[model samples]
Target: MSNGKPVYKLIDGKGRVLIPKELRSAAGMDYGDIVRLGVTNGRVSIRKIDIIEVGDQSPDAVKAYVRAAFKTMPDDTRLSLIAELTELLKQKKEV
Candidate 1:
């Protein structure tokens, strides 16, 4: 009865509806990747989680990536990994 997105019907004795293969391909989701779902102010958005490779798990590489992320973050958001690290270092020095 809804004219929005196409709805799949539950079939057989069990209630199960499959995700359309076309939609899955469009979303870039695969068998093993994780997905995060959230709704804010009544708007919903889905984003695929980033998969970190083995080579990128090193401390130096991770720190570099985090620093790069901070550089591109918007000025309005004061929350930053760099600021948190700085505060942690200052606290360590005081101890």
Candidate 2:
């Protein structure tokens, strides 16, 4: 899957494209996993979304967890997350 060769896939009539098993395995994707899709400049990207549960945690504990997790995220992902959070905050402010 990492051979630097492109794999072609056909889009079904319903506009669904099936990801091959090898590529999915390489990307750490599996059945039932949540994924984020981004389209830019005629290119489409897919990334698996990681979910974290912080139920009932203290504010400081949650902050600590987020800080640690943020440190390990890729720069692009961190920026995207920040942009999303900013948009949410703006919407909340408007409300």
Could you tell me every candidate's TM-score relative to the true structure?
0.34, 0.51
**Where's the lowest-lDDT run of ten residues in candidate 2?**
52-61
Alpha-carbon deviation at 59 in model 1, angstroms: 24
The best candidate in terms of lDDT: 2
Model 2 C-alpha RMSD vs. true structure (Å) is: 14.0
Q: TM-score winner among the candidates?
A: 2
> 3-47, model 1: which lDDT tens digit per residue?
347655565667444556666677786654444456999965556
**lDDT of model 2 at residue 17?**
99
Tell me, what's the RMSD of every candidate? 14.6, 14.0
Q: Any runs in candidate 1 off by more than 4 Å, and if so which?
A: 1-18, 51-95
Error of 1 at 41 (Å): 1.8
Measure candidate 1: CA RMSD: 14.6
